[model samples]
Target: MALLIPASFGNLAVSRRAHVSLTVSASANPRTFHRESVDWVKETASFFDQDKRPIMLFDGVCNLCNGGVKFVRDHDRNRRIRFEALQSEAGKRLLMRSGRAPDDISSVVLVEKDRSYTKSEAVLKIMEYIDLPFPQLAFFMQFVPLFARDSVYDNIANNRYAIFGWSESCEI
Candidate 1:
């Protein structure tokens, strides 16, 4: 199901698990394989235990992205994060509601009640929920201006496939 608000330039997609993958070269480089479209809605998807916490919408097949999730899951002793693929039904719903573009990221997103964050801002927000050492980074990230931070993030996003590699039709 694709939820698109054409007037608002908002589009979110939930692909049924077809297990099919599409391979494309990175726009930043032609030598890398970049696949980020995949089937992700599971047999069951619920928002239980997610009411007051941050919703972490991430890329499901990116090793780096998934690894980040694992790190958060391991450190989230308070269970403060709710995991969802941006390609899942619930995820697409929330992203659209939060006013974020669906296919516009290579990093995890942190969705709070009244706002959404991306790139470094989002990562720092997630860090706030993690343990000590991680939280420390949040404070440092604050020293960087938002524009600078976002610029760096964009560079990484544009180069993620070249640097990190991607599976065929990557999904999250």
Candidate 2:
């Protein structure tokens, strides 16, 4: 059985097994779902640790996602972000604990102290920690309405495999 719960981000499909899957509608801006439910935050805290460095979760088999991880690692001179492929055990655990479906790896997830950011919001938050022009670009991009930004994001995500191809296993 599945229970439908209304959240600030979108409607959540909570399975009887307690798995939570985020379902975003075309009319809803993905950024609007920034606040993770308090219960979720509390549950994931032990696994993620409240004070550790931020973790970036990406699709391991996607060439584009892997490239993105490499770009962030290269640009992050301070090394503020640690990455894990969505298929990894740590990644799967975090996703389940945070109420997201482990198999839904279309979006890059930025897991911070008390919250997780997905889609365009995740990209922008990651950019804020990177060096030079990226932060500036992120700041500029902020003005583009969240829905509009996520629309572009969704288009790319939907075709990422077709455009970038996928490996049988995660490269990282």
Candidate 3:
């Protein structure tokens, strides 16, 4: 499952030069995808805190996604969630292992010991781990039509870059 920030029209808290400013320069949002799913490859690995906890896979070049990561990190009081930038070795591998299309990198991918999900399914699952009002939204899972739910999620994913702005790929 996944989580969300209530949609709004305020100016984003992200930057436009992107992360590449830390390095050199490159522009153009690459649209071509090379494969169906990155998961076909051998599964990659991740770092754990002293105790074991799952991390999330995200687009590192996306300021909005990164900001979301920070928000999750800050709010997850149990420190139950960690992170994996979608561009990272582990992030890509997890995407594949979870049965998501590599080139389709749209949803917030979660890697538990077993499986993964996309769109509203994934978002709602992420909320489950966070507890409280987030987990409460899980109830919506039973009543909403999948197409109706996913269409909304799809619109948001497709427009995310335009709305949030992106940076060059980064290592953070």
Candidate 4:
């Protein structure tokens, strides 16, 4: 049997064998849907250079989230990732385009050229994009069951503010 799931980026087909695939149409432009206005999309698309870098959306007020972004930046010597606070205009737009609530700041989001990933999946993708050791580590982590990985991610995300504390102001 096969299960069809509709996503903002594309249609996902999951088979009983546990195989899953995503198919995005050629005409579906992520930037067009993620931006409020066509003009803004055009301008920001050029300014951000989305083609060359993946966008990371993080909870700006969460201390742990800020630290994670900082860590990614420090390690990403090749500058493969671009960051935006989930509360920021650009981030909110992307969240909306991805069919997530703008106020849902619990999970880290990774937006690539044609698709988006959240929670543990997002973390793994970000690791793969970063240098050497991380890519090797991410490849190993991929062997872990998705549900198990995401469950752990959710537990930490749900208690992140209490455990790591939150800031009054949103930091980069």
Model 2 over residues 1-172: C-alpha lDDT tens digits? 2222223535545332224344533234656545433244444566555548888999888889999999999999999898987766567556654468655687899987667789999999999999999999999999999999999999999999889987777787
- Prediction 3 TM-score vs. true: 0.67
Q: How far is candidate 4 from the true structure (C-alpha RMSD, Å)?
A: 11.1
Better of 1 and 2 by TM-score: 2
Ranking by lDDT: 2, 4, 1, 3
Please report, in order, the local distance difference test score of every candidate based on alpha carbons.
0.62, 0.74, 0.60, 0.71
Candidate 4 clashing pairs?
A: none
Candidate 4 per-residue lDDT over residues 1-172, each given as its tens digit: 1112222433434231213233433244655543322222332344346365889999888899999999999889999999988776577556655556545677999976556799999999999988889999999999999999999999999998889988876676
- Provide the clashing-pair count of each candidate structure: 4, 1, 11, 0
lDDT of 3 by residue, 130-169 (tens): 8577777777673698898899988988888899877777
Winner by TM-score between candidate 4 and candidate 2 = 2
Q: Specify the highest-TM-score model's number.
A: 2
**By summed lDDT, which 10 consecutive residues of candidate 2 come out lowest?**
1-10
Runs of candidate 2 with Cα error greater than 4 angstroms are 1-40, 47-51
Q: Model 2 TM-score?
A: 0.73
Residue 89 of model 3 has an lDDT of: 47
Supply candidate 1's per-residue lDDT for 28: 23
Best by lDDT: 2
Residue 90 in candidate 1, Cα distance off native in Å: 1.4
Q: Provide the global lDDT of candidate 1 against the true structure.
A: 0.62
- The better-scoring model by TM-score among 1 and 4 is 4
